[model samples]
Target chain A: MSKGKIYLIPTTLGDSPINDVLPPKTIDILSQLQHFAVENIRTTRRYIKKVIPEKDINQITFHLLNKHTSISEIRHILQSVEQGIDLGIISEAGNPCIADPGSLLTREAHRNNLQIIPLTGPSSILLALISSGMNGQNFAFNGYLPISPQERIKKLRQLEKKSQSEQQPQIFMETPYRNKQMIESIIKTCHPETLLCIATNLTLSNEFIKTAPISYWKKHIPEIHKQPCIFIIGA
Target chain B: MSKGKIYLIPTTLGDSPINDVLPPKTIDILSQLQHFAVENIRTTRRYIKKVIPEKDINQITFHLLNKHTSISEIRHILQSVEQGIDLGIISEAGNPCIADPGSLLTREAHRNNLQIIPLTGPSSILLALISSGMNGQNFAFNGYLPISPQERIKKLRQLEKKSQSEQQPQIFMETPYRNKQMIESIIKTCHPETLLCIATNLTLSNEFIKTAPISYWKKHIPEIHKQPCIFIIGA
Candidate 1:
């Protein structure tokens, strides 16, 4: 029997409307699939219901794939595909495999010669980069920064230096509650002329996406505590 | 009068259907905008008609922003926004600003304090990365590698070393016709055990996406000549 293809489905970021963020065909594909490997079961089920109100939640089988999911469990999920049952990886927000545990399953899919299809949808990292007016041609995503203050400051300096040398934009995110501290570290560790873009509340109402020099950010301190943010440092 | 915002619009990759790659709201947004800064006027008009066949093409004003477009011309496009006329940037394919000159206009928009809205859509780079199942948590998009054979080999060596040291995946592309030569350089320059992913014709019917070690690729050289491709090197 031919194996089922693994679809890497993308979810909306924050509270953005489904229609506004996802293609119509994404909904169509989701309704047809009966199995999913999701990060958060509650959010994924709710999202599925919200997008396709008529979809029967009871008919679907979801496999948990959070921090605690084991390799054997992921292998089992792939085994279901080996039985010709297609499965999808759904993240709580944004595209799967990006800043999520979905990559573990995707890597396995590649290892086992499973076909992987990545759908088009909202990605805060990509959205933030284009909107920042920074160097999009060459950029790096370093995921979240070091939580320790000293290490975070050192990392910020290294990022700034690399950006200057390579002429490439550096992208990094922070824990929601620690966003304010992240901004301060960026402002203090980088030169005054270095550009810093702070993109917060993406894809939601009252979104704030702006890029300015460190000096300007220092003079006008932003109130972004508790808000999810993507920071980019540019030469 | 309030300042008109700049919208960063995305176009479909290859011959993929519009509905499959873009949200319905994107079409709605494009039809409402009267001015566009595009990489190619002919292709943009053709794509606009293909997506919204009922819309009147005569009402739209297209500003040329290709290789010959000067800084002064891009500045004029932004100036139109000063008159409260909203404008959109449309690339030849995929999202604007990445691997295109659209960012020059976007950078000026940021300097002038114009609000920029980047719509979510098909980004080949992001799609390739997600589908590759590599280290999406930390990766870099380095645009295109050096075209010269010697420089290309040296660059591949450097990329492989960086991927090994930083444990970060490096992504780069090549002109369509030179894809075969690029693969040859990668196979010859990198270590046998290094992982490489070749994603070609993404979001199309005959899409080919796979990842394997350099040794495997050497044994099975891909016939990706004249096909647009994204190459990724992982540790």
Candidate 2:
């Protein structure tokens, strides 16, 4: 009989200083894992070195598990847990099974009856939602807008209509460089009265969560074209 | 001018045992607050003493604050901050401002331009949503449904229809003791094929996050009528 084992630890939001705020017990658990499933092996190695500097952490090899990984790799992850090996899964930042990369693995872990453990840490989505003061009762997170301007506008329009009719909040993110275009699309396509929330640099020294009507945004965010940001519209 | 003062600091769920899981810096911040505004000052004081035994937290008084407190009392809180006093806001458990008691104070703090610090902690709603594998992209937290079954059902039906039509996720909670009827109501009113998630004992030893179609839940959930659960229906 194998020991029950599964760990889903939260990493920090990649570019924030608060990104380094993992609990001590989580670090202790990381050191105990027989194999660490990391989104980026190089970055994971550096993070571990910072905490456990004197140890040979490289002995515990990392299995890169990103979106491109084959389904076979998921099976190996399940197999390792079945053998009683504690497996630590982490995204580049924030909670793993969230809007981040580890949901597929988490779904499989659930099916296999593995003991899933969720550790505490920074979560950009929750922070944005709570502070947005929009509707917290009913909200949806649309991961990323289409990069093409036309497609992005089309999706934004659909989201806006759905959000308004249902009185539910709609949230989405954009690449650092494409932020301006996304904001512009929101201004052009969304109702001027629509409530828009921009949460940028969350949990960092410069964390900001701003909520304003769409018309007000056009006047202020003239040059915010390219920055990694989470945009929210409350119906 | 007096130094900028501390504001509310909501922590993770469960007993203070979970507090041990927070980052070290968070603990340091909690310690520095000269005053803690909590639902139960005694409980908060006891929790602080248990977690950080060496620190004499007696000098840091706790001002009991709850939903019953008046607007003038809220002003008094701000006045203390103006006098260079620090404040820590804690709920019975979990993060504040999520249908919790400290929201008024939080708003007041924001209006006053006081530096509001939100610590990364557990939120039952987020825990339930992420683990349930429901629609995470957009969610609306309705807080708690009406106590009367008829009103509750009406709200549930409205939410169900809206969710289905808009593809939005609706979230709500019930007191721990009222968990059973909430589940039954959903099983009877929501469509048989509708997806429902029941998250209970979040961040606690007995925590469980369960999901199933309403029809399946109707037949399987004999012990889950009123048990302090958060229900999620994903359209």
Who wins the TM-score comparison?
Answer: 1
User: What range of 10 consecutive residues in model 2 chain A has the weakest lDDT sum?
Assistant: A13-22
Per-prediction TM-score to the true structure, in the order listed:
0.98, 0.83
What is the C-alpha lDDT profile of model 1 across A25-111, one tens digit per residue? 777788889999999999999999888899999999999987688889899999999889988889978999888888888888888
lDDT of every model, 2 decimals: 0.89, 0.72
Scanning candidate 1 chain B in windows of ten residues, the lowest lDDT window is B19-28
* Top model number, lDDT: 1
- Candidate 2: regions farther than 4 A off: A15-20, A69-73, A133-138, A150-169, A187-195, A212-219, A222-227, B2-8, B37-42, B53-58, B61-76, B79-85, B157-169, B190-195, B213-228
Which regions of candidate 1 fall more than 4 Å away from where they truly are? none
**Candidate 2 residue lDDT tens string, B105-191:** 755664565656566777777767667655545556778889999999999999899678867678888887788878878888999
Residue A232 lDDT in candidate 1: 93
Report how far residue A207 has shifted in candidate 1, in Å: 1.5
